[model samples]
Target: MHKEQEKVTDKNRFKSCMMKPDEEGNIYCPQGHAFTLEQRKESVKGRYPRTIQFYRNEHCEGCPLRSQCTRSKHGRTLQRTDKLAEMQIEIRENLMTETGQELMKQRSI
Candidate 1:
């Protein structure tokens, strides 16, 4: 993968592990604070174009995990996109199928 792609994936992995969005598109912090969708914009970060969704929370100011959670004075922030999310779901489903298992085995070679 490209360096930029790797960076994005790592950043996304970190955020997704820290905060996950539900089916209703609501993301919550580790302390159970809900993040609201701030904006949706089309962005071109790499060779591919994608739509970015920005989510933010306002309750991190006094939270004990603030320092550990985010460096932004504006509280915790997260970004995601529908395409990546859907791809993740599809990949998860693919990994369960026999063809995916075979593909994985081949990839280990």
Candidate 2:
């Protein structure tokens, strides 16, 4: 007999798994659409002082995937800091490992 495994049905999974960031701070969507850095906003002084950068994809204006990607009238916008994006990618990669899965299993119990 075979046991059934739990399926992940989170909708936001596409957002996290589709976006890829390059070394130059440029992010690319699943369709190979590149989003360039549009603006950098400074953050207030706090425990984590990091500047947030906003990216915009001009090609999203008439793209068929616009509806699925974003609802903005202007274009698709993405926000992230270089350091934060790197950290998040690292954390996500770690969470996919065997050790991480074991740790997560323990947390559920």
Candidate 3:
């Protein structure tokens, strides 16, 4: 039996599994399609109140990677909460500090 070897390099390595939105608030799929904000919902009744934002890519109908990306006919969608976004920003800032860098290096994930 023969098996194919995986090709991984620095150019293709990703630090996080999730694709982050750009500074301008553009969310891109794994295939590089730009997703637009579709809706904003608030969950005031929930135990953890937060604002949810929805993003969708209209051009996914003809995308070759559609089947792999999603099973729904709605193409690809990304949902993020306002609190999560704020936390992400704060985490990024902390990760840039010396203490955060040392913490990252010490962790054994």
Per-residue lDDT of candidate 1, residues 22-47 (tens digit): 77868888778899888999979879
For candidate 3, write residues 12-103 as lDDT tens digits.
32212255778897877767779888999988765777788888888888887677667778777778886876786698789789998898
TM-score of each: 0.75, 0.67, 0.65
In candidate 2, list every pair of residues with a backbone clash: none
Instruction: Write down the TM-score for model 3.
Output: 0.65
Residue 2 error, candidate 2, Å: 23
- Name the regions of candidate 3 deviating beyond 4 angstroms: 1-17, 45-48, 101-109
lDDT of 2 by residue, 1-109 (tens): 0011223233442363446566775677655788887899988666877888888888887787777777889887877776876786687678789998898889889
Candidate with best lDDT: 1
TM-score of 2: 0.67
* Superposition error at 64 for model 2 (Å): 1.4
- lDDT for every model? 0.76, 0.70, 0.69
